[model samples]
Structure formats: C-alpha cells, structure tokens
Target: MVESLPQTRSVSAEAAAENRAWVSDLSSTGDRRELASRRLYDVLLRAARSEAGRRAARLRLAGPELDDIAHQAAADALLAICGKVETFRGDCKFTTWAYKFVIFDVGAKVNRHFWQRAGVAFDEEDWERLPARLGVGPEAHAESRDLMAAVRRAVDETLTAKQRTVFVALVLNGMPTDVLAEQLGATQNAIYKTMFDARRKLRTALIAAGYLQEHQPA
Candidate 1:
C-alpha cells in the first residue's frame, strides 16, 4: 500500500498504465518481445538522428557520418535500455525514460566519432608553440620565460614518458581527452589519471622552485 501510494502520487494513472504496458511487452517471450524491441529501437533511432543532425555542424560531420553515429547510438541505447529496464520505476512515461538512454548514448557516440574523425598529432613544432598556446605573448615571453621554463623542466624531469605524452597532448596541444584516448589506445579515465599525476608532479616541482605559490591552482 505504501509503495502504491508513492507511485500514485508521483505518476499519473495514464503514465503508470503506459509504463506497465511497455514493461510487459518488453519482458514477454518470443514474437511479442521482438516486436516491442523493434518499435523501441525505431523510437530511439529517430531521437538519435535528430540529436546527431543538430550536432553535425559542430562535429564537422556530414549526412552519411551523422546517420552512422545516429545508428550506432540507437543500437547501443537499445542494449542499455534492455539491460537497465528493471531499474525503471514509472516516475514518467516509459518512452520518456527510455529516450534518456538514447540521448546519453548519442552524446558518447558523437564524442567518439568526432575524435576518430579529427586526429590529434603532436610534433616538435607543436612543442615549441607551447608558450603561444598557453597565451604567453612574445612581449611577455621574457617575463613569463622563467615560469614556462620551470614548467618545461618539471615536465621533463618529474613525469614518466606516458605522463608527459598525455600532459603535452591534452594540456599544451589543446587536444580533446577523447581524441588523446583514441590515439593512445587508452581509456579516457586512464588518460585523465595520467594527466592528474603529471599535474601533481609539476605543481610540486614549481612550488619547490618558487615559481608558483603553494596556494596557486595547478
């Protein structure tokens, strides 16, 4: 009775009934579940396509690429929805809850697609441009030279090879973490961890060298 009260208070009767119907259809065996799955995928595909189209310009993707991302998102979202359907509590209509999965998948897939399409290449020339990339103007180079030199020294002296690569690619080169992850054949979390360790080491070195105060942000 208490559980029923919560559902009644939170979900309209129509929404609750619709949610139950969706759950039942999805949970059924054989033909019924197959048909329901197809319908749900179609709904998710349309939503993903809309989102992909909207993001096409920013992602530098054309129609075929956008359609590919949309299809991948919809397929992944369907698997996610099926796996997590038991977590649904009828707080809203089932379709609404399901659409959230598609939206999230679209975002992740889009990031992956963008990173794969846009390469992050780091070279010695890019290394030399660090001062410019960090917004240290030529006029201010003399004033900021010590700080930049300290950062370079710290990076070379304090960090491991992998950490240095991740730091240079992600921080100095303005490469997206996803792009770095793809290039390095690593996970984004792993790339982030490497960057974190690199920053911590650099912060310690700069603080010790008197270039950065202990209170300054890393």
Candidate 2:
C-alpha cells in the first residue's frame, strides 16, 4: 500500500490472515486511534509491571523503586508502540508484538539497576584477585595459577585502558554490556564492539604466549 503493493498483495496466506486480524482490532470502534492508543499503553503498563516484579525479588528493590521502573518502562513502551503502530503487519498478535518492546525497556532498566547499587573496579588491584576464580586441585591449580598470571600480564600489557575496562568488567565481573553502557553514559552497540575487539586482542595474546591454541575447534 505504501508503494510496495506487489509485496503486500503477494504475501503468504499466513500473512494475509494476519492482515485480516490486524483489521479486526483497528475497526473495533469509530474513535479507533484514540481507543487503540489508550488500550495499548494500558497493556504495555501491565507487561512492564510483570517484568519488573520478576526482577525485583532477586534484586531486592523497594516497592517504590519497582513501581518507578514499571512506570518508566511503560512510558517508553508507549512511545515505541505509538511510533510504530503504522508498521504493524500482524506477524503476531498485537499484544505479543507490543509486549516485546515493554520487556526490552524493563530489562534494560533492570540491568542498569545493578550498576546503580554498586560499581565494579577493573584495575590492576582487581586483576591480582583474578586467580581466585581458577580453583583447587594442586596439579590443575598450578596450571590455573599459571594461566591467570599469563592473563594478567597479557591484559595489563597488551590492552589499552578502555579495552581493559570493557574486557574486565564484562568477562571478569560478569557485568552485561547494557548495564555497563548505561552506567558509563554510552551506547550498547559501542560497548559490545569494544568488548569484541578486546576479546580478539586477548585471544591473540594468549595464543602467542602459548596459553591458548592458535586454532580452536568447535
């Protein structure tokens, strides 16, 4: 319909059925957009609250904080839904598609919640503690200690400061990229790429140091 009539008309029977389903909701009332917008926001709010509740127990956030997260997620989801309403092709139910964005918003907020409570240090002092993660069997322990030492030297010597922070916080501290980006006021894509590049550098370092093989099998 939007200058892509052929693709729309030739869509699979399943997509045609989905198109029909989209109509039923759109044509339900005369004040269609108004009613639909209200309904969409309400449903999004419920979905956001559902996700927030699931995370709050584990994170131990207070009631007010949980409510705030849900509301913020709902607000963001409403904008997403409204902005993309015209693009809905009913590939899935309206509710299902709408729920996905709310979940995304809620998940990001929950990840950021982790950083708000505490900060992870990715410094030389912390790297010295990395050997603890490699555990207890005297023979294997010796190998672990050696590997940790190599890793420490490789990380400190080979990587730049920014790469070290991204690599250490992500790999060692187990912080998700989204949480790190939010805490640092950066983009998720940028952090992920930095981590990827850092990983490549680390692998190259390990292989060169004889700690890892040049070619690893799947």
- RMSD of each candidate? 7.6, 8.2
Model 1 weakest lDDT span, ten residues long: 1-10
- Model 1, 17-73: lDDT tens digits are 778777777777789889989999999999999988875665457778789889999
Count of steric clashes across candidates, in order: 0, 0
Lowest summed lDDT over 10 consecutive residues: which window, candidate 2?
Answer: 1-10
- Over 4 Å off, model 1: 1-6, 119-189, 193-218
What tens-digit string does per-residue lDDT give for candidate 2 at 9-95? 445666656545444444455676567667767888888888899866645675888889999999898778767656766555667
- Residue 26 displacement in candidate 1 (angstroms): 0.2
Alpha-carbon shift of residue 47 in model 2 (angstroms):
1.2
Residue 103 C-alpha lDDT in model 2: 93
Leading candidate by lDDT:
1
| C-alpha lDDT score of every prediction, in listed order | 0.74, 0.68
